[model samples]
Target: MVYENGKAWEKIVKWFGYKLHLIVDATYELPIMYSLTKASESDIKEGHRMLERMEEKQAEILKRAETMVANRGYDDTKLIIKCWDKYRIKPVNDIRNLWRDGEKTRLLTNYKNVAYNYKGNVYCYCPETGT
Candidate 1:
């Protein structure tokens, strides 16, 4: 089978290979489940797929699990909500810097006393030394 496998650019090296997504237990730090896909496959989608696979392959573990902690890559509202509404698992994913606690913009390009939210909201500051 031929597919459009993705490319990865890391630092100064550019290469083409598959992406491996792994899920591990928080305490034991051991592998739980994993899936390989094209480099272009998104982290959130792959992560969700891994979760669904767990539902079938490891129902016992899923039943005892309470939260799925993920990095900012899976910091999607819809996915988080779905994890809660569908599986009753709380997604403890961290939002990107754009949504950092009461912080500024995503890019923070040449702007001061100005902050932007993920949902297209803007915050204005008085510039009075952390106001």
Candidate 2:
């Protein structure tokens, strides 16, 4: 797998933030997976590159496994391979505190305060829109 990150490890340490790129193959009962750290690179920049690298690596692994399986020829066993991608981001802020009642949910607390929330509210001014 390929890991992509800018030179922002210091910021990540200070703010308790992390970014990850993960791939999983779950077709079989015993899943196979790979993951890598991506500190602060944009998804658009790293997405395609990471996927391509993972595909190549997974193909090699599968070929090796296939050869082994053919040699052994295990009985009544199935080999199903799957590949998928995942990404995660954590901003350095307590979102629960930003809420009205400040009641933290189980998902929020479990994720180390790193989950997106969409309560019943709307914002007229969106920073991304610059409106």
Candidate 3:
């Protein structure tokens, strides 16, 4: 797997090795926390563990955070809800298109005009244009 963020790129090719999950303060461009795990470990699982650890030990830092930025690898529904409901921190993570059956957009419940794409981007359908 290749984790690409603009100019910085991290490639995970080795089968038998350790993976380092590091959380950084983006404003300062400094690392705040880290976790080392086996290469087989899932990013979502590690992400939950990291959040738990932060809540238990360094909650002050978590409280200061307004948003948590992550890649699609960490785009689990539960994790996203947890970040918002528990800490009130908005998650700015990339979403993966998990839609099967060639779904393009899903209409929002209770809102006739509003619909969202697989990426969670909301849009309004025009009745006149039939769009």
Where model 2 places Cα greater than 4 Å from the true spot, the runs are 1-16, 29-33, 60-131
Ranking by lDDT: 3, 1, 2
- Candidate 2 structure quality by residue, lDDT tens digits, 26-130: 345463543354454443334445545645666564433321111111111111112111211111221223456554332344444344444423333343653
Off by over 4 Å in 3: 1-14, 100-117, 120-131
lDDT of 3 by residue, 1-131 (tens): 34465465656576798989999999999999999999988999999999999999999999999999998989999999999999998999998889986989998998888899987789998867868
Best by lDDT: 3
lDDT per residue for candidate 1 within 28-86, as digits (tens), equals 88888888888766888887788788889998887777888888988877789878987
- lDDT, model 2: 0.36
Arrange candidates by TM-score, descending. 3, 1, 2
* Candidate 3: clashing pairs of residues: none
* Per-model TM against the reference: 0.61, 0.27, 0.67
Residue-level lDDT for 80 in candidate 2: 12
On the 0 to 100 scale, the lDDT of residue 111 in model 2 is 42
